[model samples]
Structure formats: C-alpha cells, structure tokens
Target: MTIRLAAVAAPFGRDLDECFATIERLAFRARSEGASVLALPEACLGGYLANLGGEAAGPPALRRDGPELARLAGIAGDMVICAGYCEAEGDLRFNSVVCVTGDGILGHHRKVHQPLRENQSYAAGDGFTAFDTPAGRMGMMICYDKAFPESARSLALDGAQIVVCVSAWPASRTDPAPDLADDRWTRRFDLFDQARALENQVVWVSSNQSGTFGDLRFVGRAKIVGPGGEILAATGVSAGVAVASLDLEETLATARRSMGHLRDRRPEAYAAGF
Candidate 1:
C-alpha cells in the first residue's frame, strides 16, 4: 500500500510539556501533509543524556502504560507515531521506543545496542522484533543500534518492510570538523542509514536530535531512504521533517526483483560470529 512517511529532526530537552508541544506541532504538520507514519527523534519525550559520561543523571523514567504515552496516543489520532523515551521498570530504566495510534500501542522496542557509557545509565535490551502498524509491518531501533548490520537485518528477517531508527547522534568531540557536513560522525550516520536499507532492501526512516544539548552537538540529517539506497527526502544538516510517498509493495518488488538480499542470504555460511 502507498503511504506517506515523515522523519523528524528537532531539538528536545528535559521538559515534558515543552516536548509534547513540539510533538503536537510536528504531528499536525505531518498529518496535514498526508503522512501516515511519523518518526520522532530518540529521547524526544524527556531528552537524551547531557553527555556520554556516567556522571550525569538520566532523563525521567516513564512507564509504557503511563499518562504520558496515553497522551501521546491521543495526539497521534489516526496517524502512527513512533517516539523514544526512558522506560521505567521498577528500579531499572531502559532506552526505548514506542509505536502508537489513537486506539493504543502497536509496538515497542528497547534499544539493544549501547554505546560508550550508555550502559551505565540504562540496562540493555535483549532482542529485535517487528510488529504490525497502520502504515505497515515496522521495526524500531535507537542511536548506536544502526551501526551494527545485525540489528536491521534481524528486523528484516522478522518481516519488517520499514525500519525507523531514532537517534541523538552527535558530531565528533575531538578534532571536530568546521563544517558539520564534513564531520566523520555525521558521515557515518548517513552511511549507516543508506547501508542498512540497501543491504536489507527495506525502507529506512532516520530521525535525529538537532542543535546542541549540554556537552554534545547533534547532527540533524533526518531522511527517508528507498530500498535501493536512494534518499527520497532529506532535511540535510538542519531541524525539519523529511517526507516521502511510495507504495511499499511496489517499492520492495522493484528493489528485490533481481537479486533479493534476504532471499540470497547465506546464513549457514557464517556460523561462527552470528
């Protein structure tokens, strides 16, 4: 089915009310543009960590069944919205994402891969899974998860036609590039988005935090990439929404017609590491 998808790149801080306002504004904009699915940046609800250091306290931990997510679902209305927040489970907190519509929650994903001092703040997730949504069969991941090919691959193997990766990725700390576009981390961010989509032959939606947050400077390059690794819509290095329209079945058919990446996978060939 044909669907309009929007990936967001905007700044979100520690304030929940302010973040909801931003999400409401952006959701309205996307809905007006006929978007069926909207992907918000990682930690867009309560904000990401000030730094990768273990010293800083984490964002407010929210429950999946709490009023915050319920409010988010109400704001979502008919549109499928994917957003990140700190998930609370008793004394432990997890870096997680949730997909919801006006009716209720559809899917949830806890970020499986932790980078640097992230493990110090939150417990790690154990697996990757795909679930059905109004838009299509979808999967989610956060920040550093996209770096590993296995993450996206696992989703695709689980029947995800589209993958949304929300991030709070920042530019390099040492020897930072004068131009954000030339920054190595920014380049890696873009490369991972394209490479994951191309290798798995799935539609890729990448959303990231924009502007500086405490000690880290985020690279806003939100984009919708086609299964062929072509960028359909991108916000470049600024805060904005990248929107695109395409027929999921047709797009996947076109990309997989000749040499299907999933069809030709040699899982048996690589038994040592995987």
Candidate 2:
C-alpha cells in the first residue's frame, strides 16, 4: 500500500492560535495531496520558548488527555497527525511527541536524549516504544535524538517502517562556537537523515522549526528519505511541507534483499570490544 506523508515547518515562539492556524493550513494542503499523515515541527503548539526558572510557575502541565489534545483530535480527519510539545506529568516535565488521529491522541514519546538547554527544562525519557497507526507502525524521536543511530535502530527493530522526527534545532549557537557554514551545515544535517534511513532500512521523515529564536536561527531542511537513503522530497530554509509517497511493501522487499550485512553478523565474536 502507498502512504503519502508530509513534513511541515512552522516558526517557533508563536501563540497557540497562530500555531493551530498554521497547522490547519498545512493539514489542508497535505489532505489535498492525499497524504495519510502529516508530521509537524517540534514544540509547534507552545513555541520553543522554555522558561527554565519559571517552568514551575507556568500553567498546570498539559497532558495527552487535555483540552489542547482534544482540540487537535477533533481537527484531524482520517489522516494521522504527529507533533511535538512540552508535557507535564505531576512534578516532572518532558519534551514529548503526541500522535493524534480522529479518535484522539494515540500515544506519546518522551525525548530520550535531552540536549543542552533542554536538560534545564525537561526530564529524559526512559525507553522507546512504537505506536500502531492507520498507515503503519510509527515511531517518534526529537531533534538531538536523530544524531544517535541507536534511536532509529531501536525503532526499526521494534517494527517501525516510518520514523517521524520533530525538531527545533537552533539556527546558531553562540556558546558552541559559531554555527557551521550553511553549505557545511546542510551537508551534515542531510548526512544524518541519510544515515538513519540506510541503517534502519526505513523511511525517515523530519519536520523542523524555522525562523530566528533570539540570536539562534533554525536551519529548515525538512525532508523525506527512502529506505536506501535516497532523498524523496525536501524543503528549503522556509516554512513549508514536503510531501512524498511511500510504499512500505516495496521498502521492505528492498531492505530484505540488501540485508546481506544482517545475515552475516558476528556479534558473539565482537565481545572483546566491550
């Protein structure tokens, strides 16, 4: 079966209404293209403006069962939607991805690898899990998690054919030296996406936040890569969605045929490295 997917980019730090309006427009476009699911940028709902010291004073933590989730669920049609947000559960805060459908939120993924500023605002997730959706078994990971191959590998091992990544990657960081030049940065970013797709033999879709947040600027290179590490579709440094059609059965066949490495594993012989 063919599944159409979309990756949507939105500016960070926008209000809830503005964000939802953007989502509505993107979802409409995706639906027009017969997309079965649309994946949106990280922290798109509340903006990525986290007040570390004031998190305790912020409004009560929003849960998957909250009004916001219900509102999103209502907006979703037959297509599935995935987006990132800050989650509050008791005293702990998490950087989370919510998978929504017409029925409501299907499942949530707490980011396992917290990056620099995130550690001050959110707790790390303990484990990874895949959620069954109308299209296929879907898995989620946030920005920094994409740099770790194990994250995607775990999802693939768990039977995820499509892995969605939502991210608010900083455009530039003052503390971490200057940002990599545009060409270098783009190459590095695309390499990671390609690596994830090739290693897991699964489709990789990423949605990233765009525009400047303070001095930091987001490199909006949202894209979809096929199982063999081919770029199916990509977006520029502007806010938009990249739509592509994916055939899971064909992808699986390709993976199995090229998995000579999988059949020739020597894991037991490599214990000396450990």
Candidate 3:
C-alpha cells in the first residue's frame, strides 16, 4: 500500500497560540491532501531565538507531557506527525522533536549536536534511536543532528525505514545570501538530505522553517527524498509543502536489493577518528 507523506516549510513565530493555530491550518491542509505523515520544522512551536547568548536566547521551554504537545497530537490523529520544539525537562532545556499519531507519541528525540553556542541555550541529548509507530518504524532528528552521518546511520541500524529531520535551519549567518537558494548553507542542507537517504537506503523527509526570524533568514527547501537519493517532491525556497507517496516495504526492498550499504559493513576496519 502506498501512503502519502508531506514535509512542510512554513513560519511559526514567537506566540504559542499563534504557532498552534498555524499548525492547525497546515494539518487541515495536509489531511485534505491525503497526507498520512507530516513533518514540520524545528522549533516550529515557538520561534527560534535570534541569538544563543546569555539571557537573550531563551525560547519558551515546554515539557514533553505539556498541553502544547498534547494539542499537537490532537491534530495528528491518524496522520503521523513529526515536529520540533524546545523541550523542558526540569531546569534543563533541549532542542527536541516528537512524533505523534492519533494514538499518542510514538517517539521523542532531543537534538544531539550543539552548533556554535547552541549549547549555551540547550542541553545536549545522549544518543540516537528509532521507534515504532502506526505509520512504520521511523527515527527523528533535529536540525544540527542531520549534519553528522552517524545520526542517520544509527537510526538505520535500529531498523528505521524512514527518517524525519526537522530544522529551523537559517541561511548563512555570516555571509548572508542574496538569494536563499544560492546560500552555501542551503546547498549543504540539500546535500546532507540526499547523502543520508542514499547511504542508509531509507526514505528521508526534511522540513524547515520559512521566512525570517530576528537576524536569521531560513532556507525553505523542504523535501521528500527517495532511498536512491532522488528528490521525489520539494518546495523550493518558499513556504510550501512537499508531498510524495511511498510503498514502504517495496521501496526498502528495491533500494537494498543490489548493494545493501548497511549489510556490506566495514565498521570494524574504520578508525574512530574521522
């Protein structure tokens, strides 16, 4: 059976109420379009802070069991939704993503890599993992997590057939791009999506925030990548949704048929230091 999937590139600003409202509208649209799975950007529930500095960079911290995520899950009924947010566990905050269905949360993954002074604002998660859901076996990763090859590889080894990477990824922070699409950061983002999908032979769904926030201008290139590293659908440099259909089992079988990257392992031969 083929199931429709969508990755959204849209804006969700500072206000909690407004953010939820935007998510609702998008969820309604996805349902109408027959999307069985939806992926939203990192920190989509609250605006990403302008700077990761003392006192100024704190985005609103929400608990995993909080009303916010519950409200998101309410809209998620049937359609599996993977979305990013700032997670508050006691006093520590972590950049995180949660996957939900009508039933409830299937998995929650905290952003494992802290870029620049991102560690100044959020605590780091320990590792990577994949989980089971109504849709299929899947893994979740936040923005910076996808930069590392091991992040996706670990999930693949854990039996994940599909990996959802949600980001609040912005255009070049230093040398700003005249066009968001031409930015080096945007290019790297696309490359990572394709490499991760092909290397692991897993379906990749990439979603990001669109428009500008504080000093940042996000590159909205949300896409659905096939196991062969081909883009099935994409929303180029704009606030839009990228949709594609995948016959889960068959797709995986075909991608791994001739040369299974995971099966042809050389983990023992490679040095730990890259």
Give the candidate number with the greatest TM-score.
Answer: 1
What lDDT does each candidate get?
0.95, 0.79, 0.91
> Which regions of candidate 2 fall more than 4 Å away from where they truly are?
50-60, 174-184, 260-266, 269-274
**Candidate 2 clashes between residue pairs 3 or more apart in a chain or in different chains:** 171-217, 171-218
Query: Across residues 164-229, which tens digit of lDDT does each residue of candidate 1 receive?
Result: 999999999997899998999999999999999999999999999999998999999999999999
Best of the candidates, lDDT: 1
The C-alpha TM-scores of every prediction are: 0.98, 0.89, 0.97
Q: How many backbone clashes can be found in candidate 1?
A: 0
Candidate 1 vs candidate 3: the TM-score winner is 1
In candidate 1, the residue pairs with backbone N, CA or C atoms under 3 Å apart (3 or more residues apart, or in different chains) clash, namely none
How would you encode candidate 3's per-residue C-alpha lDDT over 132-226 as one tens digit per residue?
97778999998889899999999999999999999988899889778889999999999999999999999999999999887778999999999
Better of 2 and 3 by lDDT: 3
At residue 135, candidate 1 shows an lDDT of 86
Task: List runs of model 1 lying over 4 Å from the truth.
Answer: none
lDDT of 2 by residue, 1-274 (tens): 9989998766856467777888888888999999998999888877775442434433234687789888777778788999888788887888888999998887689999976666777889976788899989888999889888778877877888789999877644433324333645556677888899887778889898887664456777889888888988988767788899978878767776957334455769866642
Off by over 4 Å in 3: 54-57, 272-274
All candidates in order of TM-score, best leading: 1, 3, 2
